[model samples]
Structures are given as structure tokens and as C-alpha cells.
Target chain A: MYVAVKGGEKAIDNAHKYLAEERRGATDVAELSLSQISEQLSHAVSRVMAEGSLYDKDLAALAIKQARGDLIEAIFLIRAYRTTLPRFGYSAPLDTSEMDLDRRISATFKDLPGGQVLGPTFDYTHRLLDFALAAEGLEPQKAEAAEAPLDEEVPRVLELLNAEGLIEQSAPADYDDTAPVGDLTREPLEFPADRDLRLQNLARGDEGFILALGYSTQRGYARNHAFVGEVRLGDVTVEVIPEELGFAIEIGDITITECETVNQFQGSKTAPAQFTRGYGLAFGHSERKVISMALVDRALRCHELGEDQVAPVQDDEFVLSHSDNIQATGFVEHIKLPHYVDFQSELELVRRLRRNAEDNIREAAE
Target chain B: MALDSSPGDPSRKNWMGILARASETDLENFWQLHGQEEDYDFLRRPEIGLVMVQGRAGGTGGRFNLGEMTVTRCSVRLSDGTVGHAYIAGRNQRHAELAAAFDALLQNPERQEEIEDTVITPLQKRHQQGRDDRSKKAAATKVDFYTMVRGED
Candidate 1:
């Protein structure tokens, strides 16, 4: 009666055993350590952490190792692990104005305050393959003396323009800074999302998918002219307050990447022309992700800006809903699960309809 | 954004920060030697679970699911009525229990100074040292160029 269940349990158990064995790979080869993955492959760990939405470098490292360096798989592992923990409390949003700047640059200004730091970027690197890195066991060099810590604050490029009424105002005319942000994880996302919600979606959106969508906007999909106002990467303090304590405490610092792009705007009938901004921020030094996100952010703002929403990336619901890889991957991979019961019923219905049609045709012939 | 308003009253915030930043090993080792003599009942037994991580594109933008990570959390109440809770990243139940024990100890007014000196100070030092090491490595690559002043003949 339930032949589908027969032998499946044992087969599944053995399959898991085989997978564990396969995960070990060749025993002769030295196994990759979590520390190596966390340190040497830090960028990968950062990407997984960013995409997984959890900031623990240790967990991300373990995930990468467990997933055999498959980043999406590692992200999935991190995501699943994150779901069960108790919510300590929401962290106070970071004050990036005081970011411990690692990398800061402005495309709009040649010599901006907090002079450009091209820190460890691949931008100027030749793409030549380094044969030296192919071999193993290089001695860990002692670190050089650190730079004196940057002053706690730096002038943001966007703020400089805002002071002169160049960029569109960030807050509303009567902006309440205390308004509760929409948490997409806690509640369903409503259409025509506010800037905060849209940013949240993009922040966790698949970097590759968001990059392509953002790229699309640049490639004439929504040809909005944009100049990189500022790009900064740094560590920001995370602070949280317990309800019982009734006061704030610094939790820790997390590294973040922020991009602010100034887009060209024309005067509409009701409003005067001003430079509107598109913003992107992500968990780590995801320069590409942030830049792409900024472009898409501007593209998505077309309707709000009184511009025609002709581009695919400009479709708010379409972009927001499809951007998450976890949601997308879960739904897509679910297809492999057993669907024979539903398929059988549909098959029966089609056969019955065909028989009825044949009988009707015979009667008509007679 | 209002979430940043100085978290709760400041006094407890400082200690909670200490609690949040300590590595699992540091907390465990500290508890193993110092805080292990206390009697406590499980208010919540240590268990593994998931938390949905959310991220905002660029740091302050809209939120999206980052993914999940495994966490172990435990809660306990000391015999003397002090309550404690602990949540650490990953699936180590022993670490959670030790953390919970230490958390209760930190809340104890009588033991606060003792625990802070023995546990928090060492952990903070380690965290700072780690940061210093990272900063040093990154700073090695820092390049600075100076502009020359024009000279009039």
C-alpha cells in the first residue's frame, strides 16, 4: 500500500554515510582547517557572512568548510543555523559617521576630507596569476606597526553636498528618526516599500543577482546618470540595550561597506531639481555589491522621482521578491521533493477528460 | 535608526557588552576555573537552534535574509535566585552552560567585581590584541603620498 516508503529509510541513512565519507575526500591530503578558511580565505568567509546575514566569522568559516567551499551552500548552512537562536534584542543601528575607515574614496571629489584610502583594493592590480601562491607553507610574517587610529569621525561626502542643498534631503521634512523600521523577516513585505525596507532587501539580496540587476540599469535599462559620491568601508560599533537595563551598551564592532551614489535629477512640476541619491550598504567590504546595489537602488526610485518605470529593475515587487537567494533556492530546490501524489491526481483527471471526449466523438459519428 | 539611542541605562550596558564580545573558549575557560562552584538549576536547558540573520544592503538600507546560523542557548537560575541566560554562535552546549553560569555570576552584585577582574578583563585584552594584530597587517599596505609646495624664485 505504501511501496514508496519501502527501503527508502535505509537508503537515505546509507546515502548520508556515503556523503560524510565523500566529504573527507582523499585521506592522504591534509584536511583544510577552519582557521585557514577563516583567515587566508577571509574574503570568502566575509561574503558568506554577508550573504548569510550573520556576523560571526567563526560560524561562516565552519560553514564554508562544511559546505566544501560552496559559498551559496555555506550561506544556506549559516542561514539554517541562525534561525533557532533566541533574539537577544535588536542592535541600535550603526552610526557610520564614526566608522574606523579602512577604505574611503569619492569619485565626485578629487581631494575630499578624509583623503582617499585605496586600501587593499584589487582596482589597481594587474590580473596576472601569481604562481608563488600555488605552493604551500609560507611563514606567517610578523605584522607591521598599525597606523595611528583615524579620528573617530570623518566628513561624509554626501553630507558636504547636503550642506549646500545640492543633494535631495535624506530625511523627510518632518522626519522622525525614532520610527520603527520594517523587518521583512518578522512581517510580510508590502508593495511600494519604503527606502529602509528596500535597502534591507538589497542588503541581503544575492550579490550576483543584485549585481546583474544593477548592471542592467547601467547598461541603458534605466539609463540614470550617476556619480559615486562616496564609498567607505570600516568597522562600526554595534550597541544594544536590554529592556530590564533601560540603557545602551556597546555590543561590538562589525565591519561594513557603504556606497552612496548621486544621481542626476530633473525638475518636476511640483519639485525643484536636485541631485537624488542612491544608497547601498552591506555587511563587509563588498565594494562590487554595494556599487551595484546603489545603481539598482536609484533605478528602483524612478517612480518616486516622477520618472517613468519602464525598466525591469525598476519593478519594486519583482526586484525585491526575487533578490533573495535563500528564498529563491528553497523554492527552486523543492521541485526535487516527492510530488507524485499531486501528479497522479492530475494524470487521472486528464485521462478521464480524454475518455469522455472520445465517447462524445463516437456518438457524434453515429 | 533610533535603535542607536544610547542603549538602555548605561551601567548595565557596559557589562552586557563584555558578555557579548567574549569568545566561547574564553568564557568557558573563565567559568571552568572561577565560576564552577555555584549551584544552579536549569531555567532553560541548553539547546541548539537557528536565528534568521537579516542584512541591509549597504549598512543602513533595506533588510534581506542573510541566512541562518546554528546557535546554542541556555538559561539558569542560581540557588540564591540569580537568573542568567547565554547564547553563543554554533552548537556547543557545554559552552552555553558555562556562559550561562558566568552570566549569572556577573549579575550578582556581590561577585561583580571578582568576575569582572578575572573574566572580563582577560577577554577584553585578548579581543583588543586580536584587533591590534589585524590593524597592523592591514596598515602594512597603507600608501601615503605628500604634495609638494610650490617655490617662487
Candidate 2:
């Protein structure tokens, strides 16, 4: 039970003032601008956006600034701000196949349609610290441009396997857009959650948490022999068919990272052995997060695929309930918020019980 | 609000995509130069809202809610009664208003060619240039694997 204790109004106000001053840091240093955070610390902003479940880069950057670089705090701020805004509608499910490809690669196949394009990535970079970045006014070398541009559309690697029926199809044969999809934001997540709900949960799940869960699976805790089928990063146009407009109009584009994992699935008596699929998608270039999401996604699909649910990751309720960091942080951190009354009640009970026990022992002796 | 009688016009979709994706600064400059004198009334005032973004299960399967993105939408009716609607990403009120105003203006047959030339064309060029620059750089990074012949072979 929570009790509202009054008083300390002046102290609370002064504490906030001190916090503001502290947030400014040393006066000699130039202030960090929102643009700088949005541009330079973009990966941080992306994580906040992905976890916060909001897409406004500027607002995410501002939240990061307000939270003093505490990403979870920034995500909390974003989530809070999101609740206040009115919802317009839902966008058409993004067609990632038509995405303006920046980075596309496949681990399962060396050569595939729309040959591997390595866009801007740190995969090949040595992890040594570049002190040159610390000093300002350093002009970075420009990247070389190819004589000819890449193809407009690149086929997904999974599509190649789908052609030969070697891998299970990702979409249903009778997929319909009009069919209502489960939205956890609008409704509470119920048990026996479908793949849609699971994906949504993992999409916004805490990166580190999801990464750990995915890594555990790799260490033989429900290992599916996962192969990185494809990882693509680029901008995809978002379209919403406004009621008034009666036709779809592009709202804008958002950069996202998508991962598709091909897992080994031994066929049953009635079915033929074919590779299965796991999917992960998140806002911005969240490579690690998406990859983790894909692995967890596949693990949660054990029941559907007729596999034994022997691991924690295979349990949908456990993964989905604890995936959201905002929810997790609130329950964990609420203990710090004035639990004095509750503690006092417990203290009194303990003292009374101890006294009664001592008195009973003395009476017996007498 | 009256619906667009001919919603199947592909050009309208293309131009709207371009306008929605155009940078805020560029849109503002274009509006100031070509559309400052345009008269329109707000059917729906510029309001910030959320649009739930959905994604496919396996990039080709059933749909699922990914997350909500910030979108500002507005509706405007021109003096000549042509209605324009804008649903752009992000929370810029002025950007929505300007895009709606242009949409209404672009719908006018008399002014269509002129506005398309003066405003939309330049914006499209700038947008194309930015896309090409990034695509080219990415193209440069495409790996070309080569196999070396061993002396034993």
C-alpha cells in the first residue's frame, strides 16, 4: 500500500534546482546541443527510440539530454510523453523488400541476388580507440563512390530458399491486411500469445536483456542451430491510408535494422525436414538488438514448431512480461520511494512477536 | 471532408511522398518563395499525434505492431474548394501545415504545372541528390570476393 506523506516541499524544490545545476556540469565547457546528440550520439538515440517505442529522433535526443545520457531514463521520458499524445491511426505494414538498401548481407550464402553490399558498418573496423575523434576540427576522409549505383531492389536471401521449398515460408499463404493484429499497447497481453504479439514485445524489448537471452540460446540453452540468414539496414517508407484521403500517402521514412534467422527444423512424420525462420526488426541501426530479437523469436516458436519447450526463452509469458525495461525498472525502483510507513508496520510486528516469545520462555522457567 | 474523387492518381502519390520526405528547412524555403500568398483555411488544424507502425512477421508474412511513431497531420481547403491533406512523420506543426497547403495548391489544375515546376521539381531534385549520394557511397562498399589459384592445383 502507498501512502501520501506530506511536507518537505521546500526541500524537494531545492533538490530539483541543484539537479538542474548539476545537469549543466562545469560552466567552462560548451553546452551540448540536441542536434549534436541526434547526429554524433545517434546510436544512443536509436536505442532510446527502439526501447522507448517512439520514432521521433529529435524528441529522443531531447529526452537523452534531459535524462543526462541515462538511456533507460530517456526511454522512460519518451514512453511518458507518448502516452499523452493522441493516436491518429496505423500505417500499412512496411514492405522491407522495397527498402532503400544501405547495408545488406547474408551469412548463409556467399553469393546471392543483389550481391552483398556492406554499406556503413563497423564490422571490419579494428576496435582500437581513435584519439583523433577526441580533438575537434578533424576533417574525416570522404568515402569513395562507385561508378554505377546498386540495383533499385534487392531480393531477400530467404526468398531464394523459399523458391526451392527448402525453408518454411515467413508469411501465411492467405495473409490478409484487414485481419486484426494483436496490439499490446491497446490491450493487455494474454497467455497463448501469437507470433505477432511476441514480435512486438521483442521489437521493443531491452537490448541487453534480449541480447543475453539470445546469447544463452547460443550456449546450448534451447539451441536451434541458428544461422544469420540476412541482416539489412536502410530506410523504409511509412505509409498510412488516411480515412479522409481514401488512399495511402507516405508519412515519412524511418531507418530500421532487420534480421532473419534460418534455424534447423527436423521434420515430423507428416512433414519434410526444412529450415525454419525467426525475424527481428527495430527502429534505426540496431544490429545487435535485432539479431537478438530474431534468436529469441525462434526460441519462443518451439510449441508452434512441435519442439519441446525445455528452456526459459521458449516460454512466451516469461519473456514478454519481463521484456519491457520501463515496466521492469518501475517495479524494481519503486522500493526507493518512501516505503517508511510499510517498513514501520513490519518493524512493530517483529518487536511484538519477539517480546511475546521471551515472555513465554520466562513464564515456563518460573 | 470530401474524398478525393480520383485517388488512383499515381503522380499524386509520388509527389506526396516527396513532399512528406522533404527536409523541413527545404519545405519552409520553398513555401516562402512560391506559396506564401496562397489562401487556404484549415479544415483540421495542425495537430501532433501518434501512428502505430506495423511490420510483417518474417518480412513477408502476417502483420504485427512494431511501435508507434510521431506523426503530425493537417487538412486544408483552398479558396477554390480543393482540399489537401498531409500526414507527415515527426512533430513539426509548420511542416504539416505547409505540406497541406501545397497539396491543396497542387490540386488546382490552373496552378498545377506552375507549382510543380517552381516548387516540387526543385525539392524532388534535392531529395534525389541526397539519396544518390548515400546510395553511391554504399555502392562503393560492396564487397567483391576473389578466389586465388593455389600452386598445388
lDDT (10s digit) by residue, model 2, range A1-366: 668889999999999999989999999999999999999898999999999999999999999999999999999999999999999999999999988888999999987778888988899899999999899898977999987777886898998999999999887667676889999998999998999999999999999999999998999999998999999999999999988778888988999999999997678899898999999999998999999999999999999888999889999999999999999999999888898899999999999999999999999999
Question: Which of the numbered candidates is closest to the native, going by highest lDDT?
Answer: 2
Evaluate residue A23 in candidate 2 and report its C-alpha lDDT on the 0 to 100 scale: 90
lDDT of each: 0.74, 0.91
**Which lDDT tens digits does candidate 2 get at residues B27-94?**
88888887888788999999999999999988989899999999999999877788888889998898
lDDT of 1 by residue, B1-153 (tens): 111223343434555556666776777777778877889999789887654444443334344443344556677888777876665555678777776777677777788788878887777787777665655555554545577889974
TM-score of chain A of 1: 0.90
Candidate 1 lDDT, tens digit per residue, A214-332? Answer: 88988889888889988888777665444534555554567788899989866779967788888887776789888988999889988878889888899999999999898999889
Residue A190, candidate 1: Cα error in Å is 3.6
The best candidate by TM-score is 2
**Cα error, candidate 2, residue A34 (Å):** 0.5
